[model samples]
Target chain A: MIRFEEVNFAYGARSVLRSVSLSVGFHERVAVLGGSGEGKTTILKLILGLIRPDTGSIIIDGDDITRRSESELRETRMKFSIVFQEGALFDSLDVKENVAFCLREYTDMSEDEINARVRHILASVGVEQALELMPEELSGGMHRRVSIARSLALDTPRMFLYDEPTTGLDPVNADNICGLIAELSKNGKGFIMVTHKVSDALKVADRFIFLRNGSLLFDGNRHELLNSDHPDIMIFINEVCIQGPSGA
Target chain B: MDVKRTISDLQDFYSLSLHGLLGIAGRPFYFKDALLQMDYAGAGSVVIVVIVDLFVGMALSLQLAAELSSLGLKMYIGMIVGISVVRELGPVVTALVFTGRVGAGMASELGSMALGHQVDTIRVFGLDPVKKLVTPRIVSSLIMLPALTVIGVAVSLLGGYYIAVFVSHQSGTVYWTSIRNILTVENVLAGASKPFIFAYLISSICCYMGLSTRGGSVGLRQATTRAVVMSIVMIIVADFVLTRMLLYVLGFSV
Candidate 1:
């Protein structure tokens, strides 16, 4: 489980998150909805210990990781994986090497074992054919899938932080990524995804949390989110669902 | 300054530098990368050194020939060429060439990596960016500059010797014998020594400027320019200070 208590974060003189608090339980697929510059990615960064809160503590699996040393944090970071917006795959490395990076760095597996594990994960992500392709040669969808395969290499029982997982994908690819999130959650892995995609959030998220002006405006189950009369949520639903296939 | 803060800063700087150095040291077979860098730095800049050394050597021979002939000391032309090229021109010119050629390229490459968040990604993946990226550059530059200096000395000596013996019609035997007689082991060592320090300064300054880049693409360009200019200035300043200190310590008057 991950929890943020009264977190305050600022950039220079401007406050981004002002005493905001939230908790994510294990195996909970939570969709964080927010407009641009709403500090959603900042929240994920704080939870990942990439940045520390100015005046609060972040607890991950019962440890306050805000004060941990770099080595200690790096060790603890093996418990979670992040899929960045750009996939952040090393362009210099091939697909197999990219997926095998975490395994090679943190595990004592032999090259044969690492290759086998990489093949297995790539197959799980439906990217078995892209074993030797460089990241530049892969499509956007393929890149996202490769990043997912890489993220799942560790198989840790913690969380997945996705930053705009379906941003540049076509509708079909976005839907596939959404389905992947749902399937992963069904198999009991905590997922915290930040997106502007309302339909994807509605389809995959068990719960929805809306972030605005550095604060949480709504936090409830999917049904509650759809049934509620909140004007903002209704506007979001209407714009994403009724306004053609522009969501892609 | 607080002792603790000073100590912490020193530790961080040393740790970063050592990390880079160790990463480079472990990868001893990055010879291809080294040769690529050397070609970019040394081979690409050869034209400029050749041009400048040709004119400088000609002018030097002419001036020394005139001065020595008036004083009945025309036999000292080879000595002058040997001392000048071996002691000063070789290392300084090679360093200047390196500063313009490789220093700017390194700064820009690393700065772009910083801007693209690639450096941060490497750190998050628990790899030291400095070690993986910077140390090899430092090590390669250290080796290349000295080697280039030796080459520069050879070329300049050949240029000056030709100007003195053929153009000025001096005896070839006189030229070779005077060079052999006048140049000492200390002068060669002194010239060779400066390039290592020059290479270190160039690598370190470029790396520092690169790592300090902010903003984005424009910022990276600015950092690259600053790194080249600063590296050239620092090389000259360091050369002066180091030469003076070494000479003083060696009981030389100038």
Candidate 2:
């Protein structure tokens, strides 16, 4: 459903994405793994058209988003939802308004209907009774769940994007989020999660692409990744699971 | 800062302002946000406005009454205070106060929002940050700055009236007539005109500073500080230039 064809992007004189290419099928749960500052999040930003590729194309379900205008990009952007690393809820708004934001901006839904939708999404995310709570009033875990609810608020989202969704999360919360990702995949929704958290990826992702120095270094399933002889991959996997069979 | 970089920054600042103004004209008008900001920027400012403006008026009268009494020109105290407040003090003080209060407020609010990735959230949801964020502030500043200036002028005149009656022992009717005769539509136009421009400068500069903020919480603090200092300086500077222009255009002596 999404494809990156030899995409290259730069920040000033420094290249951030270099000849990078990848794809995620409509039902695929793909995790892009990288150490910090390896340009993992930039891939999500580019795919969203927040920052365009300098060269090559990002085809979102067949549309070449690289050449799209701001108005065109807005139309394309609604097809995908992103959960930012920090949750990114509107601070001025409470949980209800934050969740209902897109609908209020884009839809003609009545106030009661919007409130109902927001209530439903928040409940689904296990955050009931905090509908009137402001973003600052919520805990970190609640913020993440609220972010998820906000993203899923969009109708017919073709693909979801997560930027380090598990960063700073406790193990139990991380597992719950992984379960949510699994559930979304079960519902036949594709998603790309960028993270350094290998356990989260192992729990939820169907495939992994390891990033190193602005390029894709390893792309494979969990079994293939664990069995690989790549030194860096072995070291990373060891960090996640100290009792790995391929332990160094 | 490099001269070229400064020029580019100015260009970006104006671009952001124009985009925000355009957002006000476009669809999906954020009437709720505009009203909320009006409450914040307008209604929320009453206490500070009252406290600061009342003192300013009282101080101007006291200082003028002291000086004019020695020359036996104490009867003209109301005239001096009236002209000064109407022509300069009222609007300038309002802008300066707004810079400290509303300008800093907008900067910190938007700065933290940027830091928390809320601005990008608007973009991710396919909403323009200009529409969602900047326009409401601009609208409120436009409505409120002028509103505050008028209040300041009225309170200052009342203070002058108090000083004239009690301190100078001038006739109430003469004191009232002195100020009333000097008050012209042209003078009102010249003074009243400034807050409109001042409002835009305060709102736009703070919005730009707030949105362009980087680093982290420290960046938000710095942006808010810069927004206030720059807004106050611009308000004062713009006041001078605008005063000159308005005087010439309205046939008032500069």
Report how far off residue A181 is in candidate 2 (Å). 1.1
RMSD after CA superposition, every candidate: 4.5, 2.4
DockQ of each: 0.33, 0.75
Off by over 4 Å in 1: A107-116, A184-187, A228-231, A243-248, B1-15, B22-77, B171-183
Scored on chain A only, each candidate's TM-score is: 0.93, 0.94
State the lDDT at B70 in candidate 1. Answer: 79
Residue B60's lDDT within candidate 2 is: 93
Alpha-carbon deviation at B61 in model 2, angstroms: 1.6
Question: Mind giving the per-residue lDDT tens digits that candidate 1 earns over A52-92?
Answer: 88899899889999888765776556667788888888766
Tens digits of per-residue lDDT for model 1, B1-254: 68996687557655655666666656324455466666766677677666666666677788888788878887789888888877787788778877887888888877877775566566566555676567768877887778777777777777778888877778889988877875766776777789988988898878777876888888998999988998888888988987887677656676
Output the worst ten-in-a-row residue range by lDDT, candidate 1 chain B: B25-34
Clashing pairs in 2: none
Q: Say what the RMSD of model 2 is.
A: 2.4
Estimate every model's Cα lDDT from 0 to 1: 0.79, 0.86
